[model samples]
Target chain A: TQLLEQSPQFLSIQEGENLTVYCNSSSVFSSLQWYRQEPGEGPVLLVTVVTGGEVKKLKRLTFQFGDARKDSSLHITAAQPGDTGLYLCAGTQTGANNLFFGTGTRLTVIP
Target chain B: DAGITQSPRHKVTETGTPVTLRCHQTENHRYMYWYRQDPGHGLRLIHYSYGVKDTDKGEVSDGYSVSRSKTEDFLLTLESATSSQTSVYFCAISELDNTEAFFGQGTRLTVV
Candidate 1:
């Protein structure tokens, strides 16, 4: 069983549309992070949320950490073709050495 | 991107053959990790090394082994390759000061 579950395994939308992806878990985490992976490339870190109820924005991307630290969400505004890629959410448990990653959500934006 | 390199960027090996993938880092970070990415699975950790001669398993450790003999290099070996093992593998390094990790380009392995 996956410790973290991400919804909308795949998404296809037109450019300029908005979309949101979610990651949920039953266990609380000390820190959570989001990453984007493109074809033929390794995943790159997008943002990290450490505190519960924290919100971070990177240009057109917005990330939110749940108050209980058990869930998180990513919202994209006016999505563009360049934003298409696999989105992954990972969480690090307290006193743990490895981060648990969620099944990714593949997004495709057509211009 | 941090100075991390994965060898054999692309490989095609037969099943039951032994394959070793190497990860070299110039950052000399204390932590090194191996992860595989698949269609449904985003990125599952196979193994990680904390320091020289120190290693541990991750969520997906079966059918794989890792060794860290030096501070700058980590090796992942598959004793017997399987078709299911065909995937893109990534190497990452992390420092003690922060949780942010730097990932290598990746190695695409195919088992026939």
Candidate 2:
């Protein structure tokens, strides 16, 4: 079984603050995806990192995949109240098409 | 949006009763999955279907059963509802690989 572990289960910070979330796993993955879910709604796709050591940015959000393909990170710069949501990382194993999701990180940005 | 819809958005049933949830997709995707989400636990797969009449068990598939007779519909049934089965259920659809999966709004079930 593949297990993904996310750090900082809950985070609260004032607006304009910078925060980072980490997702680590013991097994290597072919691809990693990040999702943000609001209260009472399903998760929505944010980004996908396929290559090891790859970095992708979406406006104020930056995502990075580890060189070993076993870890990933999401960094938000100058966070705003709209950035508050539950962040989840899912990893697809080398040969499987299913994804194993991390525990998730609930972030709250206060204005 | 992925054009995915789940029926019975919220339901309350007693133990030992049979309940079925429906998932309908218009995306024409070949893969469909059923997942359960609980507090502190992100999401656990209950069952998945690769194609019509082709279904497989997922990580957590003990008390759940699924059927897919058409490409646009999938049904998940609970033989006998239990208190522990009370959770938010989500249906997802994907094409070919695991690139980007589209999820439904989810159905919240309560077993008393």
Candidate 3:
């Protein structure tokens, strides 16, 4: 059973378009993280959100943590071909050492 | 770039055969994890180690076992390979429980 669920299992968009990916769960978490992975490589950490209702921006990418700490979202503005890859969300429950991951979203940005 | 290496990047084995995957880290991180990635399941934890000789089962540990005899090495073993176990396996290391984790390139395993 997957603790977290992500929306839009796959996405494809043209260059300069926008897209958003969502990760949701019933259980609250102490922290949430987003990762991006390309083909044949390991997933790399993109950002971490610790507080509820907090939003962080990284150039063209924006990440937001839900107020209840049970959900998160990643939005990319003006998607580029280079942004094509898999996006995964992970969370650690309060007082728990184990990390749980979502189903994942595979994004493809066409030029 | 976190000094993590997974041996036998790709392997193919027959059903019921035993296989072992090695994950070595030079960072000396205290936490190590093994995860398997499949089509719809995404990434599921197989096993994890918190310290030398300390290991625990994860959500999908039915067909997998792990050993951490040393501080820098974590090993994942399949007592009997099965087709359902075929997937890409990843190894990750972290300094703390909730902090950022560094992952290995991943090993592709096939059970025929």
Candidate 4:
């Protein structure tokens, strides 16, 4: 079973549209991260959220960690074509040696 | 860009052959990981190393083995290549546990 699940599995929207992607799990994580992967390349870290109920903003992108630390969300406002890519959420559990990644959400922003 | 390099960016091998992918990093990170990406499965860890000469298996470690004899290099080996093992493999490194990880470009392996 996937330790983390993300939805929607695939998304398509026009330029200037707004969308939200979610990552949910039954297990609580000590830290959570979001990554973006372009074609033919590996994933790159976008942001890291460690505290529960913490919200961070990166320009047009907003990330929030759930109050219980079991979920998180990524929201993009006025999305552009540059936002098209596979978005992945990863989490690290307390005392765990490895990080777990979620089933990715592939987003396509059309111009 | 994170001082990580993966060799043999693309390879095609026959079934039953052995294949090894290499990950080298200059960051001197304490943690190194190997993961495979497939359709519907996202990225699943195969193995990881915490320190030189110390390694551990991840959830999908059945057909793969890893070694970390040196702090800067991690290797993933396939005992016997199978069509099912064809996928893009990635290498990641982090300075510490539960921290931000930087990933290598990837190695695309195809078993025919």
Output the number of the lDDT-best candidate. 4
Better of 1 and 4 by lDDT: 4
Q: In angstroms, how far off is B58's CA in candidate 2?
A: 0.4
* TM-score versus the correct structure, for each prediction: 0.96, 0.98, 0.98, 0.98
- Candidate 1, residues B2-62: lDDT per residue as tens digits? 8999999999999999999999999989999999988777788999988999999888899
lDDT for each residue of candidate 2 in A20-90, tens digit (9 for 90 to 100)? 99999998999999999998788899999999999999999999999999999999999999999999999
Instruction: Go through the candidates in order and give each one's C-alpha lDDT.
Output: 0.93, 0.93, 0.94, 0.95
Task: List residue ranges in candidate 2 displaced over 4 A.
Answer: none
Greater-DockQ candidate between 3 and 4 = 4
- Looking at model 2 chain A, report the run of 10 residues with the lowest lDDT sum: A94-103
Q: Which stretches of candidate 4 lie over 4 Å from their true place?
A: none
Q: Each model's fnat? A: 0.65, 0.62, 0.78, 0.82
Model 1, C-alpha of A81: deviation from truth (Å): 1.2
Candidate 3 residue pairs in backbone clash: none
Residue B48 CA displacement from its true place in model 3, Å? 0.4
Candidate 4 local lDDT, residue B52: 97
- Indicate whether candidate 1 or candidate 4 has the larger DockQ: 4
lDDT of 1 at B39: 77
| DockQ of the two-chain complex in candidate 1 | 0.63
Give the per-residue lDDT digits (tens) of candidate 1, residues A4-101: 99989999999999999999999999989999988888879999999999999999999999999999999999999999999999999877888788
Better of 1 and 4 by TM-score: 4
